[model samples]
Target chain A: MNAPPMLEARGITRLLGEPPVQVQALKGVTLSLQPGELTLLMGPSGSGKTTLLSIFGCILAPTEGELKIAGKSTKGMTAEQLAELRRSSIGFIFQAYNLFPTLTAEENVMLALDVRRKAVTNPRQTAREALINVGLGHRLKSYPSKLSGGERQRVSIARSLIGDPSIILADEPTAALDGVNGKAVMELLSKISLDTSRSVFVVTHDSRILPFADRIVRIEDGNIVSDVRQKRA
Target chain B: MVYTLALRNFIHDRISLIVTLVGIVFSVVLMAIQIGLYYGSQQVITGMIDHSNAQLWITPIGAQSFDDSAFLKGGEKYAALSRPGVASATDVAVNIMAWKRADGGQQAVVLVGTDSDDKSLMAWNLIEGSVADMYKPNAVIADKAYLADLQVKGVGESGEVNGRKAVIVAITDHIRSFTTLPYLFTTLSRAREFMQLGPNQSGFVIVRVKPDASVAAVRADLQKNLRDVDVLTNEEFRDRSVHHWLFATGAGAALIAGAVLGLIVGVVVVAQTLYASTKDHLNEFATLRALGASAGYIHRVILVQAVLSAIIGYLIGMAEAFAVNWATRDTQLVMLITPGLALALFLITLTMCIFSAIAAIVKVTRIDPAMVFSR
Candidate 1:
């Protein structure tokens, strides 16, 4: 008997807009994530990959779906309950490196721990450690506006990892980076997934970082076209 | 952390935060000045009553207010004194008389006349000279606040009142009337001479109650004993005088309207500035929401920002108001900011800021965390 997946979605469908112009963003999409694996969700623009990621992050409710976190059914969870679940179990990284411009790198990372009301002996020290792990120790006192795009994204990645969450969701994490910085961020994500034994789900259309993924799922329109497992080189 | 974030955000956006603070400052100062003027006017209206040591006042029948009293026979003072519990009674002759300035220019003055020997009924505060100086023939006490309007130097300056040479023997502080008319305090006989009235004429009778006597009881006794005259406690006369000037004259309504207009302007400016600030930071707030921050947390952040603006702006505005008050200290329209008024205005500033933050709070509450994921 294998352990249940850390996160699972079954037959998820999302309809957006009003009656006369409703658009189905996701249709019966099914996905599962296990610990210690980096899963890449690849799709073109408007292909529902981001929509599925939003559902996995607990920010958007699926019209029809059965979602589970740590094998607990989220079938009828309220918005507040979903928010609590997200705070405790998931971490989100945006492509735009959505760090508060006013907050220093360490402060930005500390926000995740503060929001969850996690009892850490020293939040600043914990945030410092997280930033140092992401190679942002030297930039801990710098604000997002003072950092490069890669540094800002690393700060965000540090924020996502600070809580030691069960799952990490990254939406186009490397979309704003150049080839070198993009590769560095992808490798860092892969290493974090293996080192922390946390599931990493990344939504990206960039193919240059495909070698770092343990599994790849491709979506088109509103459905997943393929799912494949690959041996990391 | 919410406060910390709010402070950091405000400090980070220097230009916008300064603009918002400036708006708040303008509102606070406007309200303080307008409200200060209203209080100053009120003080002026009740100045004479407030300074007098009389426990009760006897005016002619049908007199509507202290300032509008009809002349009574000078013997009314003896009738008031004969009442039980009445310690002493003195005739007070109040009339509007023309004061001839040194340059021969005449100004209308509110002349207050009482027995010079009655020390208890003298001006409450004096800046120079003593009440004994008023015993001199044709001597008067003037308020320093009206020296410029009266065109006099100080104590010892000479002027003519109703064609009689009158010398300013003393100067008092803040003894102004609601009409902004100069006040002239002198002996009863001198005032009657200045107004060209008969020696037996008096406008009002001021009475003092014994130490062990109840003022209300003394007032009732005087009311029952005095015929064809209205006997009222000092407080009643003061309130009646204030009400007559504040309501019947339309000055109070105008002052209140100015204060209310200041409040409205402050609220609007604060609301607009705070709303614009929230709009500028909408994306960051959305990101916070996406990171599992509840609506309450974001609301607190914005409210903290507004409260900070209010506190700092209030300090600046109060400083400016004090400066204005100091500059206009010598003028008849004094700007008076009492401690109670200051505390009330502080609360008003806080309320104004919180009220202004509501629009921003609503905007932040409606922010969709899903937008963070959108392109």
Candidate 2:
């Protein structure tokens, strides 16, 4: 019972422009993501996967629909409320590895703690441990420019997990990596979700991530064409 | 925490930050030095007046217009001394003349004559030599700053004023007219002798007010008693002197206007540099917005960055101004800097940064997070 569903988006519809020339980015998205689940959103280009991901992450407001995070209705929520929810309940890993370039790997992880307004009694030690979890313990002082693609992605993952958010939203998190690094990142995400009972959602066109997910949600032209669940071994 | 992030961003922008700093530094330095010079000039004009400690100065109307040739008839002081509010009145003479040197050269000097035993005004403090010896024939006190100009390195050096032999008895601190002439203090008779005026001729009338005397009443009495003359307080005389010098031909005002124009140029350079830097990092800001930073956070970051750059620039500018002041300290360029001037510059630079930040904030706040999701 403790591993209950944590995030739910029901009948979400988001339009892009004004009436006559309106383009629907998300026709209707309905999905239940439970704790300890790894969901991969797979679709072709322009499938509205990124749009749906942004909405799930509490960043983009849907033109019309309902969203509930931890069973709380997201409707009528103020900007501050959304920011707090994003800080406490949702973690983000961008495809670009949008880490603050000025900060080192350790500091980047600490930024999450700082943003959440958490009192970091020992920032150095906490950051070291987070980097250690991502196998970047040795690169604590290395800046983002000095890190490799895989290392950078790992740092981004560490940043997301540092806040201990209930849900992790990764938008093509492994798209920038090669096969070996990409598979390693996917495995690390799967392990994190399983170990922490945190729901992980990956928006990607890369089919290689499908095997690592507990469920696969396929989208085509702004609509969820299919939802496939694969039993964990 | 947000400030830390904004500061880091500002540092990362090396070229733009440097450019902005250069602009701010130049503005601050110029503002401090130019304003300081104005203050120094004001002090120079009023320093002796303030130190004179006279309750009143009576002269002809537009007497300051003839400041270079101010002289009151010796008989006028007698009439002034008879006024009810007047405790004492003394005759003084002021004249601009050249002290001819033995080396076939001339030193520009302004002759000031005061009584050796004065109960009224104490014009220039004696830095060297005896004040009582000022009334001695051929004895005069020269401004300390003019020692080198007179080529008479020390006190007791003999010189000729208007072809009459004179000895430099005392050397006071730097006190000069707007024309930068060395002020030479002597007795009324000696000054009259040098200016070829009769013993009865005097330039200004110095009066001491009695303890219970009213200045306005005395001034009105003097104006009524004397025809075609002006009676002014020491402070009023100094103010008139400054106004005359500043607005006579509009040269000083024009120069100050030029400085103000330079400040505007600095503002424009800083504003444009900030705008370009913000534009270069537009997407980065959008990414931050998508990352759950509130619009207020984004605005604050931009303002913090701009202000940080402004402060760095201001400090650099002040440093440059100090260097300029040091280099030109011995010269007549008179580059000066003061705390109030620096404070004013800081406020100006802060305002410029705020203006620059407004543009950046507007740009960042309007950006939708959806832009980050695109490509």
Candidate 3:
């Protein structure tokens, strides 16, 4: 049998907010993430794309149904176990460029390795490599506040990629950048997705990111409307 | 990385860090001064006993301390001197007497008289003149600090003790009384004359144990011979005096209560300051959580921040405390900051900061990592 998908969500449902008026964020959503593919979950505002991404990242527990990372069932897993899964197998980038403002670019990237119990032998060297790969080698000592919008986003990407996890989750990765910077980030993401051992999952409503996607899945009203395979243009 | 995260976060908000450190420094200085006052007061209370060479003392029954002892009617000194283990014994008279200053102002003075020539229970730290000079009529040795109270300038000044003519024969320095009264040192004959008593009357008696004799045995023998007086070792008498002044009254307990209050305030202020600092970074902590940093890891980061605050605050506070000690060195309210006290204060400071970190940690743990994805 082929190896199991990097992440899987089957009949996943999620409830948010307090009872009496709690909103159903996801209603029986089913999805699977495969290695070597850049998949996009597209939807408008208030759609459950971010919620689904959170589930895939192991940051939230589904109200119902089975979720798994690397073929292992996430059902009944504790929060700590889910964190361990995310730490070891998954990386995340946010649209707002969640590079810790206090840390230099290299230190922000090293934080990923620091969170791991046992990973890279040489953290500084590995962090430099990750930043260099994301085209931030010259700005290694710069803090997030000192970097431009695009540079800060690159630092976040470097931080996400430092631990060498099997999966990358980007939440509206280019939503806050200008056109040239946005196009540059998308190109970098597309290039990173080419590594066969890694799967890239992005959640966004921006149509500008569609051409870089290897597969596109659209969601509306907390439900998937379509899933299609496409060749990257 | 934990230290890195902690230190960076600790210094990120300079205002909050200063508030936290100020709380810690205030706590340390307050506690150090209060405890130091207690030790200083104890030193003053027991200075006479500590300076004595006598192994044992014979005091009147029901005497609480040296200053409160009733005069022995007769024969306690002879009884102690007649004991087999006792080599020599001398009468020591201690009483609060009326002092008529040269300026016509009256003040209460503690008159201490010891006739032991081997320097037992005698006035120390003499700046001028000899103890032998106290034999000239009503001559006495006085401390320079008490010159204002006695209305005297230096040696050769004259004052009156209990309506009798008294002359300053020697001058000493830093010999202070816990009661803030002046101490006047004189010979036993002069003390008897000043207090209007006959030669045989005294308040306490000092006994010297022979070189080969056990002090406990000599004390037991003295107690066996003395009928109406209580025989005690010098150490036992000093402890009694200290306990009587320190615990039997509200003075020492007040100092302890103040120290405890300082500690409580320190913890609360630090806790509030740290909680505020942590709240300032709650978003980043949530981001760390969502990025797969463990709850334990985040907790460690906050605790490490508290440790840093504690160490820095403790050093600054100790420096301030030492300065306070130095400032009060020659004053009436002296502070004695020993090494042990400094170490204890450092440990207490750490506890306070760590205690403060718990409040910050609670807020951090309650944060939902999913919040990072929302905005």
Candidate 4:
């Protein structure tokens, strides 16, 4: 029998704005994400791709429907509970490479571990190991301001991976980078998804990096238009 | 690590941090100077009672304060000395008189008359000349703070005091009065001569207890034996004097109002600066929240920043206040900052910063994690 999906969203709908201007950002969107799969969410600007990613990451509560992470239903959870769940089960990467400008590369990664409030026997060692995995060992002590765009994003990726969460969510992870650096980041995400205990979700409209996705789901007007699986090259 | 985040953020934005620190420093200095002036004035109000070596005071009935004591009849000193536990008793006469300056103007002076034989009950901080100088006929000791006001060159300068020819034989330091009257020390006989009063009359009687005697017991004995008069311990008289100047006359209320105004201004400035800083960094805080940081954690970061600002600002302010105090040490307007006052001001600065940080904290706590997504 197959393993349970790492993330599952069923008939989730989200409404935005007040009366007289109410808009639906997502509607009856059902999706399942398996471990060791690199899934890409692609759509136009107002197609609710970002909103769907937010719901999947637990950053926003669904207006109606059930969502589960690691087989636990996230229905009726408080904001604080949802935050705690995110800390333990999800890692997020943004397109801006949002590393704290004042913190060093290693320190940025250590912040993730610190937020988890887990018993970290040697945080410095863990941070250094994460940075090394992202090929930033030589730049461990460099601040984001002193780093190149690619280096900063690597630090951000190191930050996301430091917590060893079950799923990684990347929102336009390569939109700010040049083609060479963007492909490099996508390759890294692909490698991370190959680990059977982990899953990667990328939300982007950039079709140039489509070859890296193991599964591509297209969204339009608050609905899922297509879901396709492609064999890895 | 959380504190490190706060420290780093503070250091990263050096310009804004320094600006906020300036606001805090301004507040601290303003409060310190105002409060210090209030304390200095209080000190001056009880200066005579505080400096006297006597353990008890005997005054006319209904004597409300040291400066406003009613005259005691002749032989009151001897009567006090005859009581048990009263080892020594001396006459003291305190009367506000006029000193005729060389410029043909008169300045109000607080004339303090003590027994000629008991020098210890007189001005103890003589900076120029000795207490023996007051024993000379028509001799009076004036505070150095009144050199320009009284228009006297120095010791040995002759002036008219209360319409009597008197020589300023000694100059004492810090013998000031809260009423802005310069203190003039003299022998009881000379004071009587200056005031043109009967030889036996005095304003109060200073009583000293024996080394082994309990001052409280001595005070009670004196109170009982002295009919139609009030007997008070030294501390009681000092408090009475301070209370009269502080609350009874409304001077204390005015000074306190000034200090409180300074505090309010400081809090407002600090609150505005910190709120602006937090608003500038709202995006970063939201990002942290999206990354699973708890509200409690973010609150700690802001509090740490405020406390750090308070500490730095307090140090700079204290240094500035001390410099001002030192620069004005010899002036009529006394600025006194005691260690206790310094500590209290430091706590006030911390409280001010914390109060100011509340505005920032509220803004931070309201930041939605969804903000990071839109950005």
- Candidate topping TM-score: 1
- Cα lDDT tens digits, model 3, B307-338, are 99889988998899889888766666656787
In model 1, what are the clashing residue pairs, if there are any?
none
Local accuracy of candidate 2 as per-residue lDDT tens digits, B24-105 = 7777777767676676666666655666667677775677532447555556778888778898887777888888875869
| Model 4, runs deviating above 4 Å | B61-64, B78-88, B102-105, B208-229
Q: For model 4, what is the error of residue B192's alpha carbon versus the real structure, in angstroms, after optimal superposition?
A: 2.0
True contacts kept of each: 0.53, 0.26, 0.60, 0.47
lDDT of 3 by residue, A1-233 (tens): 16568888899999988999899999999998888889999998888888898888888899999998888999998888888988888888998877778899998888878986556778999999999999988999998899999998888888888778899999999999988999899899999898888999999878998999999999987899999999998
Native contact share for candidate 1: 0.53
Question: Alpha-carbon error at A177 in model 2, in Å?
Answer: 1.0
Q: Summarize candidate 4's per-residue lDDT along A1-233 as a digit string, tens digits.
A: 18899999999999988988999999899999999999999999999988888888888889999899999999988877888888888888988877787789888888888987767789989999999998889999998899987888888888888779989999999898889989888888899989889999999978888999999999999999999999865
Clashing pairs in 2: B25-B317, B60-B229, B60-B230, B61-B230, B70-B203, B71-B202, B71-B203, B72-B202, B72-B203
lDDT, candidate 2, at B327: 82
Identify the superior model by DockQ, candidate 1 or candidate 2: 1
Docking class of 2: acceptable
List lDDT for all candidates, in order.
0.85, 0.78, 0.87, 0.86
Backbone clashes in model 3, listed as residue pairs: none
Q: Candidates 1 and 4: which is better by TM-score? A: 1
Residue-by-residue lDDT tens digits, candidate 1, B1-375: 687789987776788778877877787787888889888877887777776777888888867665673688557888877788989988888888788887878898888888767764576579899888898767899998888878898988888878788899999987877777888889888888877667766888878889999999988887887788888887888778777888788877887887787778778877887888899889888888778787787889999988998899899989998998998887777678999999999999899999999999999888888888877
